[model samples]
Target: MAIPAQAPPAEEVVADPVPPPDRRRSILARIWGVYAIRRIVYALSVVWLVTTGTFFMIRAMPGDPVEVLAGKLSMSGLTMDVARVRAEQALAWDPNANIFVQYFEYLGNLLRGDFGMVIGLHNTSVLDHIMKYLPWTLFSVGLGVVVAILLGMGVGMIMAYYRNGLFDHIMSAVASTLSAIPNYLGAMALILIGSTWLGLFDFWDMRGRISIGVEPGFTGEFIGDALYHAILPLITYAFTITGGWMLVMKASTTEVLGEDYVTVARARGLKGRRIGMSYVGRNSILPLIPQVALAIGTLVGGAVIVEKILFYPGIGELLIGSITTRDYPVIQGVVLILTCAVIFTNLLVDLLNSWIDPRIRKEGAST
Candidate 1:
């Protein structure tokens, strides 16, 4: 009887059917879900748009390069026809070509690493000009940004810690005033107060990136002289930007101080210093990381005005001269460089943000 019962129970024990894998979705996810790849594509698209716009806009300006050169040559007693011929011959680009044609050519040349030659400057390569001037601007502005960020973050943390006290009130007011001032205005004020009113430093002596006789090297004399000339612009940049940083960090820190983790850390008997730094300060600074890259771009653009004011020989100064002379190649080259700088920096910051915050990477992947 037991054997008969066991024999009756051995019916079909079929397994559940397994669905086929979604190969298409899996492939699409691999291609589009990568955060760095998306950011890079976006950056490249922006660079292309900027390059195109800059190319056309420069050509659309009221005066042409040939006319500008011709006018200058006429001032030197050459006949108008000869001056025009010389201008045409000296230019790396054709003034009479269709703009669309020139644009395509420019793009082709750009792809080949050819930036064309600077007009009215003995046909110097645009890349060479940039190499010569970009470093000074980077040195001055980069140092200033670093100093401003450090000073501002520290002061901001203090302001948040002492919220609404006398020191906070004083600093808030100072920050507001400084932030309201334009960077060029800051440069001017520094010149006025330091040179005109107080006679603290001679404007003439500080007009360039360095003293005339200092050779370029790692030597102390060259370094010291470069710093001396850079001091005014650096100070102007630091103070002008520091105020904004302080205000931002203060707001960020204040918000973080009210966060649950910060509160929990405090309640867990963590020391004030440890809690303030490890929990509050660290979280507060996270939002500012993206801003640092943006600040670099902003500073580079602002350098045009500040460098012009200071007579500092940075790319900004070169850009101004190019614009004034209608040097199309140099103008296009400088603007393209600046645009690339800003776009790529933002891309890098995005990737860095993804690395710093897992949530960002997760969100990016899901998309």
Candidate 2:
């Protein structure tokens, strides 16, 4: 029995030392790690889907860009054989290539920034056209959405803190009314007020961010002019989107306020301001990130209405114009761009949500 004290029972023996907990990551490091991984995956997936889908879907459309281009070039009068040869040469299209081969070639060219040409747009490269206006659209709508989130979240928090007070009731009524109104209709009314009645805005002079005759480059003057031109449309977008975010924030705050943790914090003799700022604000506001991302993504496309109303030269206008003209390549290209943007935005939201809510990170750790 004393033969080496018999190492006790196996169950009584100390197990291997449990690993120590990881140090809590600095906020910046955690955010960067989540964002970098999310972006890498998002970009790779978007490129894969867009490239393959573009090749096949573009080819599958009822009309051909090459034929459309040739017709616009007045080559419609040529013999069928000549027309066919010309179309092939113009598009560098190969009817006999396998689907995979065509897809690879299309992706290769896209990677090289050769986005082909718009058929009726007089030999303008799709990429070139997009580059010309994408920035304005992103800036206008993107800034508008930021303004919306601020207004919505700020007002909603105020209403939520007030609970059943007059401000809350008023906001509830206003949100209900605005949520039912379509964005285009709201935009139309804003346009009538700002552009027609007040005469504060000029709709016809829209070209680039600045006036039509402004220099064709980015400068402080150009940026200031563009921001000035963007103000009306930005206001319209902010107003239109505010209702949804406000409602979301209000509901989330109300729910979060009722939680036991909040009550416990209050019982700990935490001041109203401390509880509101730390417990209520942190928990309730997380619901807004995804909503903000979605709103931003949606605004990227829906900005067309406001753009048309304000006559701003942006990607939204380009999309509207492309649709009307049935410029398939350009339309498809823009759709692809917007789709990729949305997907990436969504991925970012998911990653951000995980970061903000540690339960998600804990679950990931267990796996």
Which candidate comes out best when scored by TM-score?
A: 1
TM-scores for every predicted model = 0.84, 0.70
Residue-level lDDT tens digits of model 1 in 87-198? 9988887878888888899999999999999887785899998999999999999989999999999999999999999999999999999889999999999989989999
For each candidate, the alpha-carbon lDDT, in order, equals 0.89, 0.73
> How many backbone clashes does every candidate have?
0, 0
| TM-score of model 1 vs. true structure | 0.84
Q: How far in Å is the alpha carbon of 347 misplaced in model 2? A: 1.8
